[model samples]
Target: MKRILIIATDGFEQSELEQPKKLLEEAGAETVVASLETGTIKGWEDGDWGSDVQVETTVDKVSADDFDGLLLPGGQINPDVLRLNDTVIDLIKSFDKQDKPIAAICHAPWLLIEAGLVDGKVVTAWPSVRTDLKNAGGDVIDRKVAVDGNLITSRNPDDIPAFTEALIDAVKIPAENVVEHI
Candidate 1:
């Protein structure tokens, strides 16, 4: 079975994380949620605190080699904070180094930029993050989903379906065979 590692922390976009996880599982993949700390992490929804998801493990305890892909659900706060952690950045870099699928939506691309994986890559993200991605040398587009090499990115919650589908496809096929966009 394909195993996906979902990394997030307090303030993740509720639907971005939950919907993709549900769809991935339904598509026959196993997902493990890792956070900055133990226990559960809260989500951000509609300008307020939303649901909580259990943290199966901490980021520092996981490795890119153990999972088939990485899922990064974004919220204004989630990626903003996660990007500052060295451990989180290192983990993201590890995934990129292994050429594994790294699916990031909305502001989650901020983490990708921080990990220095955006250069020369085609990607999409929340509008506010487009400038950042461009500044980081990424070919930013306004599509619902964009895939460049092993990096997959989406714009926002509304693009969750396409984003999730892209990730599932990437996981089910060899990296070189994955589609470029959706």
Candidate 2:
């Protein structure tokens, strides 16, 4: 089974993280919630504190080689705080170096910018961050989901369906001579 690493901190968008996690888990992928620290992380739902998701592994304890993909669930405060962490940014860079699938939603793409992985890539994020993303050299769009190379991005919670589907396809694409692009 493929393993996916979800890097998040407190204030993650509840649906963006929980929905895809449920889908990935049902598809038989092992999902690890990697946070800045262990214990429980809070979620943001409809502009309020939602639920809590347990952190399975801290960022310092995770190795990029052990996972098949990375996920970033966004919330206003979630990615804001994450972008300030050097270690978290380094981890994001490590996943990019490995060419592993990395998905970011809502404000989560902020970390992508901080990690220096947005240049020349097509992605979509919460409208509020469009300027920041463009300044970082990314082609920004308003689509529900955008898939470029090994990166998957979505605009918001409403886009979770397409976002989840894109991620599922990312892992399901047979690793062969086949050049199927997502």
Candidate 3:
């Protein structure tokens, strides 16, 4: 089975992580959740605290080599806090250097900027972070999803379907092709 890594922390947008994870799993990808610390991480939802997802491992212990793709789920606080961690930034950079798919949504694209992967790339994020993305030399768009080489970005929760599909497409063969052979 293909392995996909999700990097997030407390205050992640509840839907962003949960929805895509569900989609990826249903599509046959094994998903792993990594956070700054082990145990459980709480999510934010509808203007309040939300669900707590069990953390499979801490980011510092896992490596880009172990997974085929990277996912960064965004909420205002989640990416803001993660971007400040040097190890998290370096890990993101490592994934980019390997040319693996890096999918980030909403404010999660901030992590891309901090990792120095945003410059001159096309990306999308929450409205609040578009300026920051532009300032970092990213060509920010207002679409539901944006694909730039190995990077994938989406605007918000409503974009999750396209976002997850794009990520899945990068790491797996298309189902239509399998059906054709069958």
Give candidate 3's TM-score: 0.95
User: In the order shown, what is each candidate's alpha-carbon RMSD?
Assistant: 3.4, 3.8, 3.1
Best of the two (1, 3) by lDDT: 1
> Estimated TM-score per prediction?
0.94, 0.93, 0.95
lDDT of 2 by residue, 17-65 (tens): 9988887876678899999888999998887999999999899999889
Ranking by TM-score: 3, 1, 2
lDDT of 3 by residue, 1-182 (tens): 87899999999999999988888887778999999999999999999999999999999999999999999999999999999999899999999999999999999999999999999999999999999999999998999889999999999999998888888888874564322110
Find the candidate with the highest lDDT and give its number.
1
Q: Candidate 1 at residue 168, lDDT?
A: 83
- Itemize residue pairs with steric clashes in candidate 2: none
Leading candidate by TM-score: 3
Please give the CA lDDT of all the candidate structures.
0.92, 0.88, 0.91
Clashing pairs in 1: none
Better of 1 and 2 by lDDT: 1
- C-alpha displacement of 26 in model 3, angstroms? 0.3
| RMSD after Cα superposition, model 3 | 3.1
Off by over 4 Å in 2: 173-182
